[model samples]
Target: MNTTRTLIAAAIATVGTAAHAVDLKAGEWDIAIGGIVNAYYTHTSCSGSQAVGGAALATKGLGCGGTDGRTVIGNGLLPNALTTTAKTRQEGLDISATLMIGAAVASGDAISNNNNNVDVRQGFVTFGNADMGTVKLGRDYGLFGSSAILGDMTLLGAGAPVAATQRNRVTLGHIGSGYTYLGTYGQIAYSLPTSGGFSATVALMSPVDAGTAIGRNEPQLQALATARFGGGKAWLGVKRQKFEGTGGAASFTMNAAEVGASFSAGALGFAANVQSGKGLGVLTDGDSGNRKQTNVLLQATWQATAKTKFGLNWGESRLKDGAATDLRSNTNVTAGLYYGLTRSVTLVAELSRTTSKPVTGEQARMNGFALGGIVFF
Candidate 1:
């Protein structure tokens, strides 16, 4: 349920000389087909006597629920996607359409007869030229927090898994710890043509309830600006939304801002991102009480060899407003090794430790390991 401007390319790296897409020409239209398929065997172990359920982890019941550890075979952060694009030029206009379907490998664990779910993550169309920018309609990636998720190295593999029993959903890859998932949404958006490695985008997206009881009468506003220089890229993004309380809750407004940058030197790459806002849920979006929260993610990667890579990252999300018993912070650290087994396939292994701390209580901890392979074409 998440995507960035570079979601496709970033999720499925163009490895070696293997073609990431297949192009065909039919009359006046050009068509391309591409996709990624991945699966992982994940094991998680948890400790600490304190129940870290809803009190300390905002995405409670996810990852680990206590001393019980679970194992699963499932999709990673980025699900299996089959995407197709068709483009053509007509009447001095650049027109294109995209449709992507995502699938999962795991089925309901406890269900006697159940199948995995498929997500129509992206179904959008665009029309415009370089001189006039582009207008996008339908569902696509949101503007806010786009850079943060793209900057995360775990996008290629699983970083954390939800409850051991939950198999149908994709694993959590630093989602609640590093940054809130900027889920895909139906929207009408515009992108200013790129110039000098700089570009901008703005969108009005569908409203989300975000586990809160509120009335959303208007669309959410999201915008982003990005700049690239040399081996570095930086971005700034903001989002705003209005909420009217339903029942007895109080009315509130949600506002958030984020800044992120990534730099590469030699075989080493680094990334950092920070987001802070009011009414932004610690793990997701809106909050009924309009709490303040901040999240930070830092990453480093090394290209060990022509076909081998190593990476390490740490991230945390903290809530500034909470009672003594309320959740406080969720943090995670992960190390990974990725090897290119073939032109279009990669072998991945990752280890991660997650910790959740409350305002006043013993913290909870979980350690996880994931082994997987992903292929692209």
Candidate 2:
């Protein structure tokens, strides 16, 4: 697969259950395991008779028998996922290992690649404590862009289009819709001792080899630092990689940087961030591997009642090009509601609209609404 395909696969699997590992004491290993299953009823409509990529179709939604609209039982932002963790103490130090897997939900042939075949999302081990700091080694999410995802309100439902046809009905939380996803990788990460609400993270990651690009022999550095105080927190992250092309193609380099801030008081919360870089991979996950891009995100939420919350968010992802005729930007707007049905079940509803505009000034639009619930075990 190419970089775009690799990135799409990664982003498509973003809807994860993230069950709190259930602890089952088994000898020296405290085996904790759990999983979650989520699905949604989606109704999407298009302004024109074409699907995302100009594919000719009926007037109704994919399954609705018309090209202008489609309706199907879809997977929301959270997919069926399972997580297991084992922890113990050694030499007066704490140690632990975790394994997380997830897949899409559907009957489509492609769903097998995205859903039925479980993919390992997290496989890592950590060692150490407060005084000794901490060390982590394995495959997991890159430190960059994680904070932005953590604050996104789309965790409970679908926010962005994962597929052009939209039959799968599942997608990553606001990725490419409200922000960009940071590709996961294998790395050795270390956390410095915290001081006065300040902490730092540093990792040496295996060079990215998504698609046909070659992995650099040297490790890439990923760094992040944050400060938390009172009702707000701020963070910054940076990463750099040099890619060797396959098939004797030209080699290239990528550099990425992102900064974000979050605040909360009483029943109100807010977050904002901006990221920019060249060859850092957005939309294509470095497929082109040389496109310059920038993203800006803004969001806010209100806990209106003990069991109800309301939120609205907006974001824009822009690609800088040498020629004005090339692709320029994709913008999104979203509003949603979350209501607790019970401690273990939550009801979710969301509406979103996205527009893609090229330098030629033409625009293509897509709008979607998702209704779903998250059931925790």
Candidate 3:
């Protein structure tokens, strides 16, 4: 049998076997495992200097570049010091395992891999009940860290949002191959009982030391609230991060807020979001100038058929000199189509274009296209 068919059959058999085993259990203990495989090919074109080292650096003009500005696409697959290519070929597997012990102790881990290489995505334990809400300890999703409208669902390829755009400011920044370290973070989330087609969720998060950064005596806190009404949903979230006692040489704080909404009717869905933040540093002169940043996004999806879907996304980000005026900006547009080959497999193709304003005497533009497939089991 083909790989897709084999995986689907194995999943079905495993679930069936697990269900039978659970029926013989005396107490509440449950376990489940699942995974997804994604692969894609990408091509890209670029102009001017790309953003580098949190600052836009000079590029030797426009050309087709791989993942790390390597002249050869194969060389870009690995890490490099210069510009990181916005698009490249990649394949990976995301696996998740969950365990529940009675009604109080619950734990899970989500891991991803490029080929056989492992990357930890989530590892956390939870304690609580329906009436008391839940408290999660360890590394997990941060409060206000992700959007409810389209959680982690990116279309195939070159059109995918950059790592920064998809990141949750309430958590540590993403690094290396688009992975975010959960760090030492804890979360408390509560959902109110539904009434009249309305439901709400409020969450809070605190930082933990995951050893990613040492001697970093800083704390971060976040709050997020979301409400759903009929076919529409809205959310507001805020985060405050402080880095203290680095001998006043390099310490900074970031404050961010975001608002978003989404609506769905029939087979069509629409969503929009806006986020703003300021990064400030303390110096001998008392709080040197701050950097202001804003991001906005709009997206739409249509389930054209039982086996086909279409999507469009547009986003823009601007950075300024603390007055909320745009000093430099980046904008991107993407459109794509997906076709389901089976209940567990899909094929996708997409195109994307991005443009950036003048930064350090240069302008940058990039365009790319991609095609790929994904299988879930």
**Among all candidates shown, the one with the greatest TM-score:** 1
In the range 1-377, model 1's lDDT, one tens digit per residue, is: 11234465765542232546999999999999988889898877777645444424323355554336777788888778888989999999999999999877777556642254677889999998889989999998778887887778888888766653236667767777878778788999988988999989989988877554553689889999999999989999999887777767767788999999999899999999998888766556674248787889999999888888899999998877566656678898989998898878889999998888876777877788889988888
Give the alpha carbon lDDT tens digit for every residue of 285-304 in model 3: 01222456666777788888
Every candidate's lDDT: 0.78, 0.67, 0.42
Provide TM-scores for the models.
Answer: 0.93, 0.85, 0.64
- Pairs in steric clash, model 3: 67-85, 184-208
- RMSD values, in order shown: 2.7, 5.9, 12.3
Residue 191 shift from truth in candidate 1, angstroms:
1.0
Best candidate, lDDT:
1
Looking at candidate 3, what is the lDDT of residue 333? 72
Name the better of 2 and 3 by lDDT.
2
| TM accuracy, model 1 | 0.93
